[model samples]
Target chain A: MKVKVGMMSFAHLHADSYAHCLLNNPRAEFVGIADHDLRRAQQKAEQHGVQAFDSYESLLASDVQAVIICSENVKHAPLAQMAAAAGKHILCEKPLMTRLEDGQAMLTAARGAGVQLFTAFPCRFSPAFQQLRAMVQAGEIGELLAMRGTNRGVNPGGWFNDPELAGGGAMMDHTVHVADLMRLLTGQEIVEVYAETNNLMYHGNFDDVAMLTLTFEQGIFATLDSSWSRPRTFPTWGDVTLTVYGTRGVIEMDMFAQYLRHYDDRAGRIRQVFWGDNIDALMIDEFLRAVAGEPATTLATGEDGYKAAAVAIAGYESIRRGEPVKV
Target chain B: MPYFSGNGLSDTCPRRAGNLSSVVNLLTEDAMVKVGIVGLGTMGRQHAEAYRQMPDVQLSVVYDRHMDRAEAFAQEFGATVAHDLSEFLKGCEIVDICTPTYRHTEYALAAIQAGKAVVCEKPLARTLQECEQIVEAVHRHNALLMPAHVLRFFPEYRTAHQLVKAGALGTVAAVRMRRGGDFPRTKSDWYADFEKSGGIIMDLIIHDLDWVRWTLGEVERVYAKSLTFRHLEHLDYTLVTLRLRSGTIAHIEGTWCDPGGFRVSFEICGDAGMLEYDSQQMVALRVARRAEAGQAGGVEVPESPAVENPYYRELRHFIDCYRAGQSPEITVEDGMEAVRLTLAAIESARTGKVVKF
Candidate 1:
């Protein structure tokens, strides 16, 4: 029996990738797409050769067993709560929700409905990160000491630049992936956060640059450069790189480094054509396996998303107070 | 080349022998500027080589507490050895203080008081207070003082600065500068001691700190993390984040722990375009040698050739400023500001707080 999955909205850019994952997964049935903008829903549905529902309520009332939430940062909570009330599991895009209260409400609603609430953190499925975790766990780099990471990207200047829809700027958009990865690597909670955020690039009210200093509960510290600093002419979208310093040695991981440099005269710019494993497909497969009553240990849960979002939330507070704030 | 024009020499040169016309005649007749070097260490040898290449500069005296090292250096450079600081200051028209951080204030103050032009190495001094003393001495004595922040003379860095100033990358948002190498092994091993050398932040990353301040504006705040408090033997690493007054964010990483060869790189990201340079990728030449039997493999050395050496350019600029009776491009105040920013970073790392300027 294939698990039926519907997508909630196409506000986030990741919705297209997730839709393709569901269509390609053999154990899953791509049901339909529903968005407030019916034309967008129909357009995407026509592209995928699937049904288009006029309202999210109609999609919820369908026979789909699970739904993927890919709405804006602020809409994750309401959409997921509605899905849980209708007895459907959820795979929400990160960050799980914009505010802590919304995250808590989502977790409570999922628990009350007895449905799985998984956060989509595709980086956990990266082969490079998996090897790094294995080496560190196997005592190849000794005790963990510190780390430095970067999750920089070119500015996505749509709803992402709107402070209301995006919750914040680069700090909200980028910090969670690496924050979740840091937790997964150290197996510790972040205790404190100090951040410096500015909007020098665009001079918009929303910040385009954010530098965060995170201190873990286990006495380890790290810095994250979560900035929309890459220009439009960059070879690729951006990068996720982490350098782990330990007592005995160091391990560096560039997650999306498996690529061929394509210098095309036609395009008039260099480009990186990625040939790495499709991490989104891997993450979707894990979610389907869990729906099929199998264990998914590597999956990021609602709590993991909540903790990572808490780090970013504290980062904003630190910026306001001009000091480090405890998480 | 006509090295010294002797125009406006009477106002700045305290040891002028005669009236303006006679001084001009004397300078044009014999344009050799006698230069002295103190502390026969790495920098002293480097400055000696640069001076040897200049036609109008004569290396007159060399001094060090270790007389044997000074004697060897003077013999190789065909210069005389000064027995004491007084003799060294009297023998030269220009004094280059190449001593370690702890001795910078002493040598620079004495050179300034003796009314000789001074070229002091980076960091200015070990502490901000010591830097202030040198600044005050230069002002009080009306002496010529130039801090050797040689990154300004490096072609790559200069190109980057010019591009940013010219708005090649429009409204830069963020920058990352990295510099690191294995722990330096010196004769006294002072670099290993945090108190004496101020570790990597003061001794090494000050180069980037000064460059960023020069390119951008004043830093409004600083936050940092370092392994200096860990007390790891012979190893230090630091990461500093600076929020510039113009709102550009700069991240600087300095290390004395990388065993792989030295590396320097920078990335500037702006709205219109991006600029990136990595030393590891820009190598013009590389040489690798096979290991002999019963011997470890020889280390590979990568070289990137430039039109002119940055150190030579820096010294040449200093000499021009001295001859014109004008201040250098990198003034004593600029050196003090770099020291202040570095010290603030160190304080932030030690206290785990954001330090404001």
Candidate 2:
């Protein structure tokens, strides 16, 4: 028996990618999709040959045993709680919640209802990142001293720039990825953070970019520069590079370095394509595989999402008040 | 493909912003000309060392408000220590002044009144009134005055400038330059004083803004935002946006919180292809595809700093102008114009409106 999966909305940009993954994965069946935007929902549903529902209540009442909630960041927590209550496993996207209290309640509900919960942060599965982690563990990089990582991009406006809907601007949008990657790669909780956020390019109400630095519990220092203001001419897939200076040797990689092949053979020449497409689907496939008792490492645990949220939100507070904020 | 001049210029003509060559051919004197340095601070000493490197340049005198600083530079360079402004200019044909902005008017007038050539450090004067005063003095004396705009001497920046000029890329459409560094545990300290640094735009982005203007043409209008974003007891960062008279737009970022030491990058976009270069990267020159091939790495950036510093090249250029009757890489007008645009940028940032030149 295959696991049945349904998506909550076409409102979130990555939703269609998740739906395609579920339908395409032999181990999972595409149950249905629901969204306020019927045109978008219909477009995605028809493209993937899946059922489309007009309302969340109908989608939630479906026979699927699991749900992937790829909604506006603010909807992540509430939607996760609803899915957990419906006796369905949940795959919520990062920024588990903008507010800590909501995130705590979602975790509490997941535990009380005995439902598994995960957040979508697929950076951990990158082969290069995994290689970096193994090298650190093996003492190949002895006593990690410092690290710098940048995940910058042009603004993906819509809900992303809306502080209320996206939780916050660059601080909320980007710091979580680095904070989680920090905990994932270094195994140290952030002890303190001092940050400054800038609205250098996009200025009316939102800060389209932010530069943040943190001190981790284990005495390592790291800097993460995040932005939604990278020039549009930069490769759309974006660049996330990590440079770790260790006791033995310094290791650095343009994470997209491995993406040096042609995806379209008919084209005259190989074009530049950075990210592995279908990441949303790929992460979903791994989560479904884990639930089926297949071999799998932990997907971004709700705890991972919670911590990333705490630190990301704290960084926002620090920028607002102009001081360090504890996580 | 940009028709890059082997000389490192784009299709643009000479006597403009954003052009330089990497392979160094320093000024050598057929006949040595006497030179004097008016300040003995870090920048002043760099000026002296630069002069000493030129075979045709002779350090005639050294003077600083502080006698000790002046005497030290004089002894190191085998130059006489000048007791007063008149004595310094009497012996030297050219005067290099690196004094604070307020003092520029005092000594620059003295040098020009004595009919000596002059090179002053940037922010040529404390205010527009002072800049105008210096300009009047230069015109009054028919005195040659060059401001030390050393960024023009940076090889990579020179290439970007020339690439735009030579028209391999057509009219330059846009430019981006970034200059930043970690919060210096040590700064000039006086840098924190509002009157001295002229905030971020004048102190830092002035260099990049001048580079932008050099690459494109003159800026017709400017908009800027500034803030003390970090905890260094100063205005730590500023970003300036420029609209050139030629319809090019430029963005310059200047900050003191790189948090990892200095980082510098410059990029220019044109209709046919774009050129981008960074000091942090292995490849400095990137061009669009040419007739038969894709854009090639036009030049290789050394991982290490150039064996000869840019300041050295700038001083050599000055010496060539003074002794060999050669034109400087960055002439006096370039310096004055950079200062002019810098003051306009500061005004725009302060008033929160577009400032026109």
- Compare the candidates by DockQ and give the number of the best one: 1
In the predicted model 1, the residue pairs found to clash are none
**Residue by residue across B50-70, what tens digits does model 2's lDDT show?**
666555567888888788777
For model 2 the TM-score comes to 0.61
Where does the lowest 10-residue lDDT sum fall in candidate 1 chain A?
A243-252
lDDT string for model 2 (A221-242, tens) is 6667665645544444456777
lDDT by residue for model 1 (B128-237), tens: 89999999999999889999998887777878887898899998889999887667777788888888889889999999999999998799999998988888876777
Q: Which stretches of candidate 2 lie over 4 Å from their true place?
A: A260-271, A275-282, A294-298, B1-31, B34-55, B58-152, B157-276, B279-309, B317-357
Q: Which candidate is the best by TM-score?
A: 1
Collision count for each candidate, in order: 0, 18
Q: Which stretches of candidate 1 lie over 4 Å from their true place?
A: B1-29, B290-303
Q: With candidate 1 superimposed using the best TM-score fit, by how many Å does residue A63's alpha carbon deviate from the native? A: 2.5
